[model samples]
Target: MNKAIKVLAGLLVAQLLVILALQTNKPGTTQVAAQPLISVNLNTVDTLRIDDSDGGQVTLRKEGDRWQITNYGNQPADQNKVAELLQKLSDIEVRWPVASSAAAAERFEVAEGSAQKTLTFQTGDRVIDSLFMGTSPSYRRIHVRANGSDDIYQVELAQHDIPANPESWMDKTVLEFEGDILSVNAGDIAVSRDTNGDETSWKLAGSATDSTDPTLINTWVKRFNSLVVSALVPAQEVEPIIVQNPALTAHLSSDKGDADYAFYTANEKYYVKRFGSSALYEIASYQAKPIVEIEAKKFMLNTSDAEPPQ
Candidate 1:
């Protein structure tokens, strides 16, 4: 009886050990996860190419302080524009797979051979910038690899209302003036002054045949608006000898030519002069003061108050 009991105890001990060993050796219940697909660092990429689905490609290369389109004969690339593209790439956070429905698959082209694009980036060393595969009706999957890390992204061609043409953003009109005050000859004008009390108003002596012409005024206004104001002068210097009165005398001139004019707001009074030997040699000068300055004492106020506000 004693021997049978000892044998039973030995059997129980062996079974417990076996159970513990089997539990320890069995495969883990949780599965190991797959790695990500794309990664990149922008600062290191000196050269890169972005291929479009329409078979167009843009190649970017870093020049001295700027990036250039090397494939387009080394044209200058707007750095801010390229930075926006890089930001978009960096911000890609998701790459969901297309569904398996026939319409979905057809749209995504999953049955078709993978339309993959390989991007090569050259720093000091060459690296695969991105690998895009699989197409969808709305988007495509891009698998990117950079610095040995994986990033997956979904991309789609953005619909554009306007056609993509470089000329659309370029200057189209021939007479398009960009800067302030453009100067042109006004031909000729006769001048005189009307003096009433202490105040005087300068007037053109003849009826301007083209004076009320909208096109002429528009042309002159546009040109004058484009002129850059550099220095201001007193009215007496710019007026014709006959128009220059005892009360005022001064003028303004650009380093370039007399064809130009200056600008001032409507509330400001202006003294203008046309001077030259012939109508063709004419130039204009502009002098401005507050309209209230027509009052003698107010107009005589000097340079002391001209300083910029503190």
Candidate 2:
């Protein structure tokens, strides 16, 4: 009887040890993935629309493989800027949740109707996601709520707001005149230069030019070629503001018969309307005066006798 009891006790002890070993071998636990605030494949994106609180809106469309600023006269969008914007949106991960109450929305600038800015992401006219940008919690982070969710999340992005102005996305290279100019008509005055790419020699139509410094003509052409503008507004937006009687009109004809450039003066300000664009441009009076005041004699050196810049 004693031997049988000992055998049964040993069997029970062995069973318990096996169970403990089995539990120790299966000790791995499940882990949950960190959810991203905004997760959309970039290649699938179609359009990005931005609406501002000040009643301004901009639409950018992804066509083929490139993006275009659709609303601003279908202007070519700045690809580098557009890519940066897309990467920021894609990398947004929820750092933490903020206030979700209705009153908290307005105070935080994430309210459904009163948000400072709203970004609408679409895939072929179908709204995929809408993000309402709110007040910044810090310079490096912002409060944003996506898809009408009551919960406002703090994202890692530092952007205060999405770009709403079409010009903001437009490539600043509006016009790059690279052709060899053959002739120029500055208002009532007309001027012609050597067509063989030598701007040093210039002649006025029906008038004998005084002994003028050849370099002066060359320098003016260089200035005109390198002329940069502070800002350009689409003609459709502020057409009424454009002056009908321009202070100066300069028509440039390149070998390729390229576009013309016109200048206007109004309200003590100078504006330029480049060829091809319906937009009217505003240039500083100080900058525009030098180019607009160009004449046959202006090319003459100020010395007692006109001589080339030595």
* Best of the candidates, lDDT: 2
lDDT of 1 at 173: 26
**lDDT of candidate 1 over 1-310, digit per residue (tens):** 9999999999999999999888877888443443333355777778766553455466677887677766543545556666765665555554443243445433443222232333456774565455433333353433222222223334532222111222111111211233332222222422222323111232332443323232322332343333222222333433442333322222222223333222222212333222331111112233123211222121122334322111
List candidate 1 stretches off by more than 4 Å. Answer: 1-38, 52-55, 95-118, 137-310
Give the distance in Å from residue 206's predicted Cα in candidate 2 to where it truly belongs: 9.2
Clashing residue pairs in all predictions, respectively, total: 22, 1
Residue 154 accuracy (lDDT) in model 1? 44
lDDT of 2 by residue, 1-310 (tens): 9999999999999999999888767759433455777766766888999898888898999999788888876777778888888887877766447778778778889787788888888999998888888788787777888775787887766543366887777765555455676777777656678777776677666555565655666666554566655466655645655537667767777777756787877677777877666777667666678778765655555654343222
Local distance difference test values of all predictions, in order: 0.38, 0.72
TM-score per prediction, in order, is 0.36, 0.67
- lDDT: worst 10-residue window of model 1: 161-170
